[model samples]
Target: MKKIGLAWQIFIGLVLGIAVGAIFFGSPQVATYLQPIGDIFLNLIKMIVVPIVISSIIVAVAGVGDIKQLGKIGGKTILYFEIITTLAIIVGLVAANLFQPGAGIEMDKLNKTDINSYVDTAENQESHSMVDTFVNIVPTNPIAAIAEGDMLAIIFFALVFGLGISAIGEKGKPVLAFFQGTADAMFYVTNQIMKFAPFGVFALIGVTVSKFGIESLIPLGKLVFSVYGTMLFFIIVVLGSVAKLVGFNIFTLIKTLKEELILAYSTASSETVLPKIMEKMENLGVPKHIASFVIPTGYSFNLDGSTLYQALAAVFIAQMYGIEMSIADQVSLMLVLMVTSKGIAGVPGVSFVVLLATLGTVGIPVEGLAFIAGIDRILDMARTAVNVVGNSLAAIVIAKWEGKFQRNSKPKSQTTEILNVN
Candidate 1:
């Protein structure tokens, strides 16, 4: 008998999870039984992320070995990320205005969750200036940054270290070889870990569904619907246009990344698929250097999904509170979101933190977040999928811009390797 594909296995897990969750809706037993399985799976993914990022980036940059070329690629990558993410913000704002998801909702009827933790996080995040953020990206201790899983600092150190290796000429060969070996080994481990993804998806979704239940969604249905619908719009219309301009089909890209997208959505954490996305993008003809550098950096700087949700959620809270936002007020909200949304992707409750930081500036009550906190996970899952897609596409766009994209250029061996993993 032919083996089942990973995507189909994951889909089966998702469907089964929903069924079980619906059957045991609101049962604490679901959490007791399933949360550990899910946590273990997530922890396994986390274990490999930093190493994969560091090694892959070091190898990619060192392979290029030309500061001028690296700079050009970096510049083009950031520019593309900024343009696309800004478009995401604009699309979100426009969708919120048109949909008015929160308008006329009876606030008292909505279930509220404690948002004090996110508020505190927002306050701390707000205390830092842009200068501080950039400064912090240069690690005082690279080892400590890696220990803390500080992605920006780690990226900075890796880039410099890789360049150092390249600068030393033939002496760098040993170090580069070590990182290349580490990257390959970690990818092998990633494939092994992915074998457990269906179980992870089932447990994670089971917990979420049991906790929230289908009924919990009914009260905030409009907000949830609007968020999902707007994200779909952004992915298709905004990201699609970008893909077309770059001489690729968006649907094909999505199909190529279906497994990653599903895992991201189910887990509601893009980190789960980072290694796989980098691997797949390289297979799809994005150079290893471009894919490695752009995808990880995009995690921090180019969060198209999170930024869009922040824009939409900020206005959403304002609407829920019946606050009249003038055109200038909305524009200010947009600007604040554009600034505040950066460098906060991996933070727990990040969307809420961003909204808390942003809402106060626009006169939206921070407490308004309590109204939507209950449904945030449902919203988060969709956004995470979009983020994975956006970042994967970023690597491709940068590769194309650098005149390096080789369409359908995946070697037969690599194709076989991916199939074997699946």
Candidate 2:
């Protein structure tokens, strides 16, 4: 018999959620009751983000002797991420154009979004141009950024701090060692936390769909389908194509990443899976240097899913408004999306923030966000899964490109068991 694992359990959760949502369509008591279970689980995942990010970054950055290699890896990662992300956006735009998800959208009386609720003015986001974007990475205050989970700032701080640790030479060894220890400990914590995956998935999906119901998706079904379809294509086609180009079976990579993807889907936070991905990559023969450097950095920078969503949502909103943007305007929007998507931290709700930033850059109405707010939790699963897959592939591909990949020369073994990778 095929072993029934956490992924299978999550599948059960999704199936049951669909059933329960359709069953008790509007019963406030059942819906409200299930809602908190999901909320608590999401909180659990979010609780792990900051420490893991800090520990992983410090550990990854400190161990490297040649900081110049960091630039090389960074360049390759951004280049690959941008190429795939732009393609992802094009896929989204194509799907939206063909399906016309917004053609029938009744924007007559726009339901005003609680725009401030999602906006991150965080004094740190003032950098609207390229120079500011690069400079904004250097945190004005590292403590505040970590406390607030401003990822770009945190990444900038970690890189600088790690460089400082390396500069300290022998003195830095102990501190770098400590971060590695902390990273390992966090992975342990992640593993322990991930034992809750099946239950969390059960609670999360059970609660979200149960509370929201199918009717919430009725008006936005086409949009949801198109966007998700675009993401699925990116995941299978884009990622798979890249994997093939890198000389590995994409199926094996997916199988290797199944547990992480499922946990990411359930928690909807890629940060929780950082330690796990690093460990998996190393085990699969990706250099420790590459695994450490690439995976965590990719979390903060290479957000393929968010990129795809920005393009789709921008066009959907424009279509809804009957505003025909010129080809030049769309090209400009692509450049903006490329920059903003990289800056999104691997945290919950950041996608919407990136979406808002993309809209602001293009002068699109932010109110369009409210249209999908009700079903966002659902859309989040797909996006987060795509992000995890995209980040994972980017790390490995760039590692291979940089001569960091060590082909598994052992007897061919399809790794089947899903370890607790939060």
Candidate 3:
């Protein structure tokens, strides 16, 4: 563990975890005994989520001087996210159609879940339409939104508060500075938390492997491999191209962000590694303003992994039902995904939810949800890491595009380091 990289350590933990699970998968006693370890890891990550989110948003927002610019950034952010998410979904649909993953596979033999219980909840989740999507953009109660972990609502409130700080002229300077100081304090706190990352990831993966086992993955390796391969291809080809265009190296970006990705991977939630991500971006020379606005907002709008998952999973389902979607219909499916993916940021287990919400547009069976449900958790781990990559890249891209990005985070960095020293 000390000789090699943490990534290797994590790989070992994953292998061992799988071994442990396979050893005891059918044994209730062992499974029950091992359950608490996973639960503790999940809860520890979750415990930080609300505080990290609120503190980060408040600080990130306070850095934004003009709330009016919120409209411009908000507009551009949404537009860019929708376009990419749509493309991602299109990629998934096209790949599934070409690959035909579900072709000749017997769905009748595959497990079907009673998503009926989730159906009512899913139906009330989110739908695609201009008015509904637009109306829900602003939060009615920012505090309630934060407590509920509503990404969009929290974003709305932060934008407003940050802009307010900017608008209050000389009077707001103290208030803005106060929030900035608070944000700085939180960044220090997050950095300290991140030092324990490798162990946390190991524990999380260990418990997960122990619970699910390697044999469970045996039957579903096809789906997992396909999704993992697809994500890797896009991250390299597509995201690499985007990084190149901006004069950044995707490999370096990956290396720098690996710890955050691991955190997200082990926890299976993009928000899980958000604090570390924010700290890294700010340290890597992305301005605090851009990091603050784009990262959190990107969490909501620019979900490359979730978007990719939706497209791939949807097409896989249609193939299971032997449904042939037309060229025009396929394009429409991408369009719906592009729009629907934007509204799902605050949602827990949003990938499945978004897939269910939008699959109707592509003419796939919603019952197909169950067929993929067993595998969704694992799939989410891979893509949530990708989503972090996508959004972090977006922070740079949007900053470059708008020319508001500050590559200097020295003041913030020094403050953070000094706090850690103490």
Candidate 4:
């Protein structure tokens, strides 16, 4: 008998999880049993992320062997990230306004979770200015950055280290080979770890459903609907237009990333799919250098989905409290979001952190977030998928802009055969 593909296996796991979770809804035992499986899978993914990022970036930059070329790519990458993410914020704001998701809601009836943790995080985040964010990107100690999983600082160190290797001519060959080997080995390890994704997806979804039964979504369904619908609109209309201009079909790209999209949505974590995304982009004909540099940097700077949700959620919280925000007020909120949303993607509960930090400035109640915190996971899953799509597309756009995209090329062969689930 032919074996099942990974995507099908993951889908099966998702369906099974939902069914089991519904049956066991509100059972504490679900988390007690399933959380460990999910945590292990997540830990496995995290374990590989730092090494893959560092090695892949170092090899990519050194391979470019020209600071000018690297600079050009970096500039174009950041510019594209800024434009796309700004458009995402605008799209989100428009969606929230048009949908009126927060209207007609009785706040007292909804289950409000305590948001003090996110608020505390937001308070800390507010102390750091954009100038400080830029300054902190240059790691005072690269090892600490890696140990703490500080992506921006790690990326900075890798870029400079890679450049140093390139500058040394023949002497750099040994170092380059070492990183190239490391990148290759990490990809192999990623493939191996991916074999556990079905179990991870199953356990993670099971825990979510059990903890927050599907019925809990009814009270806040409008907000959930608005967020999901708006993300679809942004991806299909905004990012689709972008794909066309860059000479690729958005639908085709989606088809190409079906597995990654499903996995991202199921887990609600983009980091889980980071390694696969980079590998697949290279297979899709983006040069390794551009894919490596653009995708990881995009994680820090190009969070399209998170920015969109932050804008919509800020407006959402204001509306929830019956507070009126005029065009000027919303535009101000957008401006604040544009500044505060940057460099906080690594923070836990990042969407809430952004909203907490921005809402007070725009006259939205910081407490309003508590009203929707119960269903934030449902909203987060959708946005996480969009973030993955947006970042993947960024790699293609940068490659195209540099006149290096190879549309007609075939994907590289995998070193190991993917496991077949029977």
Candidate 5:
């Protein structure tokens, strides 16, 4: 018999994990045992991420052959990211106003999950002005930036280094060849790492379910459902429309990204799928430079799902406290979120961090975060999946816009549109 595909392996793992966790609910020991497996898997992915991103960016930029075109692509990618993210914030705000999930919430009925950790994190995080943000993108020490996994700084350094190499023409061939080999090695490593994904998904989901259980979802069901529903709407209507305008079906892109989405959703970490997404985008005819540059940058600037959650969470907290924000106040809140949400793309639990910062500024109680802390992981799963999809589509759309998308005549996608012949 033919073996099952990776997507199905992960889907099965997800299902079994949920079943096992439900069976073993209220058993902290089970979660404790399974948690390490997931942690190991995550560490393996984290170990390779910085190197893969660095190598890919350098190779992609060196291969671009024209620094002016590279800059043009960079500018267009940022513009696209900004437009899409702004739309996400607006959609999220609109959903929060229309649904008012927290309107009838009773403070006494809510579970008070300790949010001290998040609050402390928020306090320790220094808010950067726009000028400071721009300045921080240039690393003083590129090696230190890589050590800290500062993606923006690393990208900046790689772009300049790649351009310098390209400028030297024949003399730069060896440098270009070295990075090309590095990119190939990292892609192969990414493939090997992905083989462990199903097991990781199983462990992660099992632990998550066993620890949190369905009980934690009860008190804040409205808020959880609202966030999920809003995200689904944004993905289908907003992202789908954008894909249609770009002359491709969104479902086609989704089909291609099935495995990556499953991994991202189960892990609630989009970074896990970055290298794989870049590889797959190349398969779908996005040029390597565009995919590498756009996807990494999108993680920072094009955080549609996170920005949407921030807008909704801010409004949800205000409603929970019976605080009414005027139109002008909400507009101001959106403006704050727009600025505050950048520079936090791939950080763990970033949505909460962004929300914590935005809430205090908008006069909402930061402590309200405790109410939804229990359900954040569940919501995070959806958003992470959406983020992967958003980035994937961004690469495709930008490639098509640049007249670089190479369409297959067969039009076959990984998850759908396959044909069989006798």
Candidate 6:
């Protein structure tokens, strides 16, 4: 018998999980017994993320012989990230205005979760200024940065360390070689961990469905639908156009990333798929230097889906409470989101934290968050998948622009094989 493909395994797991959860809705055993499979899978991924990121960034940066080219790629990547992300926020705002998803919604009728946790996080965020954010990027203790998994600090340290290696010329070879090996080993670890994805997806989806059930989404169905619909539109219309310009079919790219996308959606965490996406991008012919740098950096800067959802959700909350936001106020919300959303990219429950922070600044009640907290996981699933896709495409587009893209004629065959050691 032919073995099932990984994507199919995950898909089946997803379907089965939902079916099982629905069959045993409100059963404590579903979460009490079955949830740990998913937790273990997430922890395993988290355990390796810092190392994979540090090694990959250092190796990619050190491999860049031309410092000017490195600067060019960085500049162009950031520009692309900003432009696309801004457009995403605008599209989301426009959709909210048109759909008015929260119009006619009664705040009292909806179930409100305890939002004090999110509020506390947001309050803490308020005290930290943007200048502090930039300065903190240069870690006081690189070791502490890695131990804490501060991505911005780790990225900064890796870039400086890599550049120092590059500056020493021949002496840098040994350092570069070490990171290259570390990155390879981490990629291998990622693959080994991915082999358990089907079980993880099954457990994660099962617990989510069993606990929340399909009914939880009905009260806020309009908001849920609006968020999903806008994300679909963004991916198909906006990111699709970019793919067309880059000389590839967006559908093809999606097909190539089906496993990562499904895993991301089921897990509701893009970090689960980051290492795999980076590997897949390299397999799709994005250079390691570009894929490594662009994917990680894009996670921080190019959160198109998150920003869009934030815009839509912010408006939805306003409409729910009969609060009116002026055009200037909405634009101001976007500007604040553009800043607050950056460094908090891969943090768990990040959207809530960001929304909490920005909601009050624009006069939307912080308590308004409780309205959607129940459905946040459902919304998060969509955004996480889109984020993985967006970051992958960012790397490919930047690679194509830099004349570094080498489209594999045998992607199916190439992706399953181990990366070339030489």
Give me the runs in candidate 3 sitting further than 4 Å from their true place.
1-12, 57-61, 68-70, 126-128, 404-422
- List candidate 1 stretches off by more than 4 Å: 411-422
Q: Rate the local accuracy (lDDT) of all candidates.
A: 0.87, 0.71, 0.71, 0.88, 0.85, 0.86
- Tens digits of per-residue lDDT for model 3, 1-422: 54876566656655666566566666666546655665655566566666655655555555555556656876787777777677677677767776777777776666555565556546866444656666776888877877777776776777677666555556766665565566666667666655555555655555566556665565556778888888888788888888898777898889988767766876687766777777778777776666766787788778898888888888778777888878887788887777677766766678877877888767787888888676677898999888999988887777777775565445353333322221
TM-score attained by model 3: 0.88
All models, RMSD in angstroms: 3.7, 5.3, 3.8, 4.4, 5.3, 3.2
Candidate 1 lDDT over residue span 273-292, tens digit each: 99999999989999887888
Model 4 — TM-score against the truth?
Answer: 0.96
> What is candidate 6's lDDT per residue for 1-422, written digit by digit as tens?
99999999999999999998899889999999889999999999999888888887777676665578888998999899989989889999999999999899977888989977767778776665667777888999999988887888888888888778777776667667777778778888999998999999999999999989999999999998999999999999999999999897889899999999999999998889888888889888988778878888888788888999999999999998888889999999889887788777656688898898888889998788897998888999999988888999999999999998988732222211212221
Residue 88 in candidate 6 has what lDDT? 88
Tens-digit lDDT string for candidate 5 (374-410): 8899999989988999999999989988999987522
- Which lDDT value does model 4 have at 173? 74
Instruction: For candidate 2, write residues 1-422 as lDDT tens digits.
Output: 98788667767776776677668766776657776876676677668766766766665566665579888877887677668778887777777677777776786543344656777641234245556656767887889888887767776787778778767776776677677667667767877776776666666666666667777777778888987888888888878888999987777888888888877776566765776777677778776656666676666667778778778878888888777777787888878777666654743477677777677668777778877676777787778888888877776798789876776622111111101110
TM-scores of the candidates in the order shown = 0.96, 0.85, 0.88, 0.96, 0.95, 0.94
Top of the candidates by lDDT: 4
> Model 6 TM-score?
0.94
TM-score of 1: 0.96
- Residue-by-residue lDDT tens digits, candidate 4, 159-248: 999889877876777777788778889999999999999999999999999889988899988999899999999999999999999899
Query: Which residue pairs in candidate 5 have backbone atoms (N, alpha carbon, C) closer than 3 angstroms, thus clashing?
Result: none
Error of 4 at 391 (Å): 0.3
Output candidate 3 Cα RMSD: 3.8
